[model samples]
Target: MKAARSDRGSQTRKLLLFTAERLFAEYGVEGVSNRQVSEAAGQSNNFAVGYHVGSKEDLVVAIVRRHAESIERRSAEMVARLPAVPALRDWVSCLVRPAVEHLASLGVPSWYARFIAQAMTHPTYRKLVFDEAFASRSFRHCHEGMFRLVPQLPEEVRRERDDMGRLMLVHMCAERERALQEGTASPRSTWESTATGLVDALVGLWLAPVTGPR
Candidate 1:
């Protein structure tokens, strides 16, 4: 009886997480309340979000955690395959491919990419989400490796481009996911192609000439 109850509880948490992710993707996180998440998740108890996932912040973190493992594992594998003296694009691929591939593996109508886009754009949740999403060791390794190939720039320029690159990756994937779900046309025919485009663009962004002062 205890085992059965535990299984049911686990199932309920997964359902809640999925429902919350979809809702949060469609509506900004601040727009959706915990009660609404619970009710939308079909929980009789309006406090299910709190009971199973704690506060709103905790729920958002939980959502990120749910997919972090697969992304981290893929990143680690890609990092392992990197040749000595890997090119800038190779390191960039380590950052881009794992995410796009994970979204691909989730099949269509997946909300994760959009959900992450929303979280990263949210004023309050942006840092919380970003830190959780990129906290993996593999991600740090990829980040360090990519920057090593980049030409030295002023600290401000580096920071600005970092933001630009992050926003590009997050929003492009979100838009592609949205387009796919709505049956609209995407620029790339496949996720792999999208990764290629992103890797190309990011390489250019990081390597572009710094025309401004310093």
Candidate 2:
């Protein structure tokens, strides 16, 4: 009986997480309340979000955590395959492919990319999401490896391009996901091609001449 109850509870939490991701993706994170998430998940108790996942912040983290493991695993595998002296595009592929591959593995109608785009842009949740994302060892490895190949720039320029690169990756994936779900046209025919395009663009973005003031 206890085992059965635990399984049901686990299933309920998964359902709430899925429902919340879709709602939060469509509606801004701040626009959706915990009660609404619970209600949307078909929970009789509106407090199911709290009981199963704690607060809104906790819910967002839970959503991120759900996908983090797969992304991290893919990242680690890619990192392991890097050559002795990985080039700019090689390291860039480490950074771009894992997330794209994970998104691809999710099949159609996946809300994770959009949900992440929303979380990254949210005022309250931005830092929390970034911290969770960058906390992975594989991410740090890819980041450091990529930057080593990139030319040195002023601190401000480096920071600016970092933000630009992040926005590009997150929003592009989100847009592609949205397009796929809506049956609209995407620039790339496959997620693999999308990752290649992002890797190419990011390499150019990081290596672009710093024509501005020193």
Candidate 3:
């Protein structure tokens, strides 16, 4: 039946995605090829990735979109609970928690955090993936709220802090994820605690006093 075929197609697509994420995470984005992804995914057809996901860039974006929906919804919910005038920490929490929360929901040994960290390292894919996140209305809402609460900052300082905050979040989660996967002890006992520590650090980063370049 049509429904049966549809179900099979969906299954194949999901398998391709799972295989690609793990491989891409282990190997860098540029290190992995479309044929390898399909082959590792156990597809008989070497062109399976090309057929199902088009280009590698398309695959990366698709993977980001898959996870972005959950993070976006959680962000929207957090935003909805905000007061008329929210604290800096509140807006920062909205940005930080949804991501860690989604990772928590995946249980242990999830590949997404590291996958994202690796994606952000590549020049072309970094902008591609981040642009995908920035396109989310919920992400934009959280940013607008966060920026409004902070002290008026020069454009350069704001840009600097933005990069700092991003690296902090991505690398922190990636480190925690690596620890969890290896069964090594983490600095924090749980994802919730990790997120709490991250929010604290980000608050300091965002609110830190800036000096002009000489």
Candidate 4:
């Protein structure tokens, strides 16, 4: 009886997380309440989200963690295959492909990219998501490898470009996902191609000459 109950509880938690991701993607995180998430998941108790996931912040983290785990595993594999002295494009591919691959694996109607785009637009949630991403060891390894190829960059320029690269990746994926869902034209036919374009652009962004602030 205890085992059966535990299984049911686990099922409920997964349902809530899945429902919340779709809800947040359609309606902004701040726009969706925990009660709505629980109710949307078909739970009689509107507090199911609270019981299983804690607060709104906790719910968001749970969703992020679920996807991050898959992305992290892919990243680890790519990192292991790095060349003895990896080029900038190689490191950039490591950073970009895992995410593109993960999104591709989800097939059509995948809400993660849009959901992430929304979370990143929120003030508090943006930091929470970024902090969670930065915590991935494989991601940090890629970051270090890419940085090593550009050690000549001033710290400020590097930081600026890093932010630009990250925003570009996130928004680009979100747009592609939206296009796929809406049956609109996408820049590339496949996620692999999308990653290629991002890697190419990021390589240029990093190698661009830094101009002093006016």
- Candidate 1 accuracy as TM-score: 0.97
C-alpha root-mean-square deviation, each candidate: 1.3, 1.2, 1.3, 1.4
Please, what is the whole-model Cα lDDT of each candidate in the order they appear? 0.92, 0.92, 0.90, 0.92
Q: Cα lDDT of model 4 overall? A: 0.92
TM-score-better candidate, 1 vs 3? 1
The window of 10 residues in a row where model 2 has the poorest summed lDDT is: 126-135
Displacement of the residue 21 alpha carbon in candidate 2, Å: 0.7
User: Residue 168 error for model 1, in Å?
Assistant: 0.7
Model 2, 31-62: lDDT tens per residue? 89999999999999999999988999999888
State the lDDT at 195 in candidate 2: 98
Off by over 4 Å in 4: none
Provide the lowest-lDDT 10-residue window in model 4: 149-158
Candidate 3 residues lying further than 4 Å off, grouped into runs, are 212-214
Q: Write the per-residue lDDT of candidate 4 for residues 170-211, one digit (tens) a residue.
A: 889999998999999998999999999999999999988877
TM-score of 4: 0.95
lDDT by residue for model 1 over 1-214, one digit each (tens)?
Answer: 9999999999999999999999999998988999999999999999999998889999898899889889999999999999988999999999999999999999989999899988887777887787888878999889998899999999999999999999999999999999999999999999999999999999999999999557
